[model samples]
Target: MRKTVRVAAIQAEPKWLRLSEGVEQVVELIGAAAASGARLVAFPETFLPGYPWWRWVDSNQWNVEYSTRCRENSMTRDGLEMRRITGAARDHGVHVVLGFGERQDRRIYMAQAVIDENGEIVSVRRKAGLNPIERKVFASGTPNLPAVRHGVIGRVGALSGQENQRPLLTRALRADEEQIHIAAWPGNPEGEAAGPDSAATVSRMYALEANAYVVAPCAVVGAAAWDRRGPQTGRGSGQARIYAAGGAEVVTPLAAGAEGILYADLEIGSAASDRREVELAARPRMRRGQQQAARTATPRRLGADRWAVPLMLGSGPGGLAAC
Candidate 1:
């Protein structure tokens, strides 16, 4: 990885259900970030066609026109929209980490596509965990899937929403030696359960624990979105920010709900200490892994969820529950 690298974390109002316009805005943002000399740019969760604001605003109305529009706007992994995004990355000579709703067959997933500086998609990871409402709307991503990718700049990985909250998921990325981690969120509205303060805390903690640079991009609901007629007040932690290994903010993050890009010139050397202060910090996890492995050694197959369950529940320390 380069000793000094510049990246752009984008926080902007999504075009909101307008896939074509969203792509245009993305291309424009790429050009703007490239002109500013950022080698990598990361966008918020489901940036294309915008996040499903109705999921929180009025989920009861999901079977309406908005839901259909959302599905219609979702881009396929290899669709024309993705091709255009790749082209933009190549044209600008910059890398892009995009979070968008991915449509496959008839299902949608919260997916992140990591495009390298050469415009090649190095990795496409879906949201690792989905809540009850999300489960109803989006398909769940495979658990324990590889998170990091070998990018032109460095080892880059991304997680959307609650994925950052999963200790095991974050631990897996750390083991992968992720150098750059993108934490994507659909802007934290103040009235929501997971508020802005908590979002910032998790992101900062991830940077510190993973010993990696974090590019957190969040999306805001502007006049163009479904929440426009609702209580779309400016109370949310909707800003792009970057953090170093020591949980230090690179730039004083953009103001909440602000539409802009946060750029950080990362000097990796500053954070690359011997890590001797906590020698067993990374290795202590081995024992816990051994215990879990022992429990799942029998590996009883669970249904569509594809979880491995151990039938020998009360049979010893090597047992796992199916439910």
Candidate 2:
């Protein structure tokens, strides 16, 4: 079916480690996207309470104080801040993909929450693995949490920061048939680089690989964030961008260090067209073992006992009875 959905990528800085203020800012952004007819809006990585850029800027011992503050300000799934975010989504009638520092027990994880238009929590996915500096403050996520969720805007999936560069992670999301994929990043002060490893390059490549709309919402490390952290550490320019199903650039890249919303009208019909050209999902070469296992597990015309015995004894012709 052909569907057109308006999506927004918010390229803005948080209120510099303040949870309540950050939530308020996000609420206003959500309202703005909704007002602009965006059915789905996505924010940058660890938008709530802000990304811990200080980890890279300050020394490990020096950043302890800042890290402590971040942990204190991190949000919980059912916390009041989350309720407010969901309330905003419900009130605006827009599905929201929000990235934040999620507090579970005593540990924090880089996570994103998918909120439905009805203001209900749909799925919360944690970053399957942490990047180098991130390991200092965040825990590794489970493999099962990387799948996409069905939303009003079709299958929505999200990955945080460096996870965008993980081919296997993107492949897993592709397997889930994501129609809209969110690549949430902490602004790359480095701006656009020549290599394929740059966030922008990887994001565009992911769009082409998945044949799905990729919405990259990046966070700007503005003066507020810098003021809290002391000084800028790396070259992180907030490069929020959107790409269509055919890997076509939809919205111009939001300027680095700028705070704004990048909007794109995604024509999902292009996905069908792109798939016809290269149907990665349907190609027989992909997931061969799993496919063979499924075919072998199919019930045969033989009596139930006969097939059951073969399957139980691991003596099937496919030699997958052990599976």
Q: Identify the leading candidate in terms of TM-score.
A: 2
Q: In candidate 1, list every pair of residues with a backbone clash.
A: 295-318
The candidate scoring highest on lDDT is: 2
Worst 10 residues of 2 by lDDT: 304-313
Query: Tens digit of lDDT per residue, candidate 1, span 241-284?
Result: 78988799988987776788999988754343445345545433
Give the per-residue lDDT of model 2 (tens digit) for 42-153.
Answer: 9988898888767767576668877788889999999999999999999999999999999988789888898899999988887766767888878877654377887657
**lDDT of each candidate versus the true structure:** 0.77, 0.79
Runs of candidate 2 exceeding 4 Å displacement: 190-192, 232-236, 273-323
TM-score of each: 0.82, 0.84
- Shift of residue 284 alpha carbon in model 2, Å: 4.7
